[model samples]
Target: MPFIAPWTGENVPSPAAMATRLGRAGYGIGYADEYGIADRVRGALWVRVPVKPGAGGPLLGRIHALRQRQAMTHMLCQGCGQPTVGGRADQRHLFLTASATGRPVAEGEKTVSPPSCAGCALEAVQEGLPSGRRYVAVLVEHAVVWGVAGIVYSPHTLAPVLRDVGNEFTLVAYDDPRLPWTLACREVVALHGCTAVDLRDLSERTPA
Candidate 1:
């Protein structure tokens, strides 16, 4: 199972007493007892989600914030929860993603998906790569912590601002001025020095 995959038992708690606070730039969302040192990341307030992996069956399209952060920060495989790199000689990490354009992944591309180990990569191919999605695999020389996928809130009303048409979530960068008011859901990373690889070729060379 993917390390960052959310289970059915893990769900976002209701915002019973959720509140906003004064930030340096503007008002930001938070709980009354929420600590900036613990909850805020890159000046953005992250949404609080329960951390209960394996409490139920895996939630296919959802991600667990804490596990996703850990996997991205430590270069752990999203497929099997193992380290992507083998040793000092193996510095490059393998990242697999669904490409909407059907083009190979490029350098300086940003993503929230974590890296995959060789074993998991093969398994993913055998399993058909998540239904109808088109996948692109790459060997990333460097994956940099970029920002986050979050909900931007209204400073005046202290309510979540509806996302723009056709957009799922607001992507806020660490340096953005509006980051303080955004409630982060997932950590995002930029893939650098990417070399796209064919899954079939990779599966052929990799042993079972």
Candidate 2:
């Protein structure tokens, strides 16, 4: 099934489970020094799962779970978890969407979502997903590995510090020195050559 988040979908919570003293990759709920990411530094924006923990666990979405898996393993499609890239420039993966129809997708667009095969991209458009209508296709011409979105912990205590007033964690880039100490969940990729295509139009041109 398509990744349907609870916020936009039914009353379903996240389909993941992780419990520790400190949050890991911003997905679970924990306390001070519990989440051990890596060697951390002070003053850096890290991306993480924002959890206000209710009864069971923090309310996480399916997309969040899928993203974590994608980060660890490269060459996987953000759309279907299938192998998209074939280790060549022309064989690079795609980040399909419908946000920019008839327009060119600019570079430097950060995407936590995974890559997609051409067939899956087309199917998503035809089948339709949560925000599928406006999300046009996005081809990742150049996907340079960026840092992750995680939480920034206290240098001494190792507890996640709230940078923003109410925000749980922040976006941490891989270039930051404190990257090792942050719990990364989503795998972020810089999108290039985002080509917006209209499926209906393409279908007409095809011989099939």
Candidate 3:
């Protein structure tokens, strides 16, 4: 199973679970039973979800918050949940992402998608691209935890800010003031020293 896949047993948490919690940073959203460091990422509050893997079939395109965070924090492959860099401490990790312009992955690009191992990179490139869009692969020398993608709550009203009609998530950096009021769903990382890889060559080494 994919590391970030959401199982059927993992239901979405209701908005009623959120309440205003005042701290040194000011008013932020928190659960009634929220723990200090455990419930936060980089001082930003994260959404809580139950851990139940293999409860049912994989829910494609949906993410389980905790699993996503785990894969990202440990640099595990989104495909097989194994170490993406393996034991090569000096080797760069591989990251794949969709590109509308068909350009190569660039340095300092922030992405919510975690790194993929060589075996899964080929599968992703073969099956993950949308109609007309291309996918790009890059070997990243550094993948730094930058921020998160989550719901931003109002500091005053303590309600979620519906920025647009359908946009429920917003990217907020660690240093951004709005982070304090946000409930993170996925961890975002910035890729540095990226070198684009050709999928044709990558497929050659993929296991049969």
Candidate 4:
């Protein structure tokens, strides 16, 4: 796929445009940090550019460049510090999938890409099991209290952990009518409670 600059508002750029930009700017294209969805649910791409010997690029540009090249940026597992690869590459193992029904449950279609390495993916899968537990618990608690169903986690609270731990969870929601305040509360609690469990044993064992 050809690269399109988000800043330019180009939805999709042709190969010629991409090559033109690359030649002019000497930028190498791969995948950007902002391209993919968490846990590989959606595909993403990163671009790398070599700055001129002494020509300093904008801070954002430099940061983006560095991020594109980071090992973790491309399926390097944060837990075991290993490159997730082969059949062991299960991105869903690292991301949590939200329940479709109002009742909280575990399991979902694996829409995301797995890690690039086995060891890293194993640790991620272990951790995701606990995360799924917490996620379901929070959802059930919210439903019992407020009688609403949907993704109940704030991105602000969830993003940090999601980014740190890995994208093993995908929040989903129902279209049933419910109070906005109740829905908000569910999301807040879900985000906060998911990470409030015993960190030491979360990945050591499955939730009872």
lDDT of 4 at 121: 31
- Over 83-186, each residue of candidate 1 has an lDDT whose tens digit, in order, gives 86662255788778876666998789889899888777777767764545777788888999999988887878878899999777888888887787788888
Residues 1-208, candidate 2, lDDT per residue (tens digit)?
3331222323335422322333223333333333334212222222334332132332343555333444325666544555665733466455654443435556787766666666656666676655423555554567776766666656566566667775444556766655645555455667766555555644412211
TM-score of each: 0.88, 0.55, 0.90, 0.20
Q: What TM-score should be assigned to candidate 3?
A: 0.90
- Of models 1 and 2, which has the larger TM-score? 1
Q: Rank the candidates by lDDT, best first.
A: 3, 1, 2, 4
lDDT of 3: 0.83
Error of 2 at 194 (Å): 3.7
By summed lDDT, which 10 consecutive residues of candidate 3 come out lowest? 199-208
What candidate 4 gets wrong by more than 4 Å, as runs, is 1-46, 49-74, 84-92, 96-201, 205-208
Query: What's the lDDT for candidate 4?
Result: 0.25
Every candidate's lDDT: 0.78, 0.49, 0.83, 0.25
Best by lDDT: 3
Per residue, candidate 3 scores C-alpha lDDT tens digits across 1-208 of 6788898888775754778888778777888888888898688898878788888777887888988898899999898899866534457888888777879877798999899888788887777666778888888889999999999988778778887675558999998999888889999999999888887778635322
Question: Poorest 10 consecutive residues of model 4 by lDDT?
Answer: 180-189
Ranked candidates (TM-score, high to low): 3, 1, 2, 4
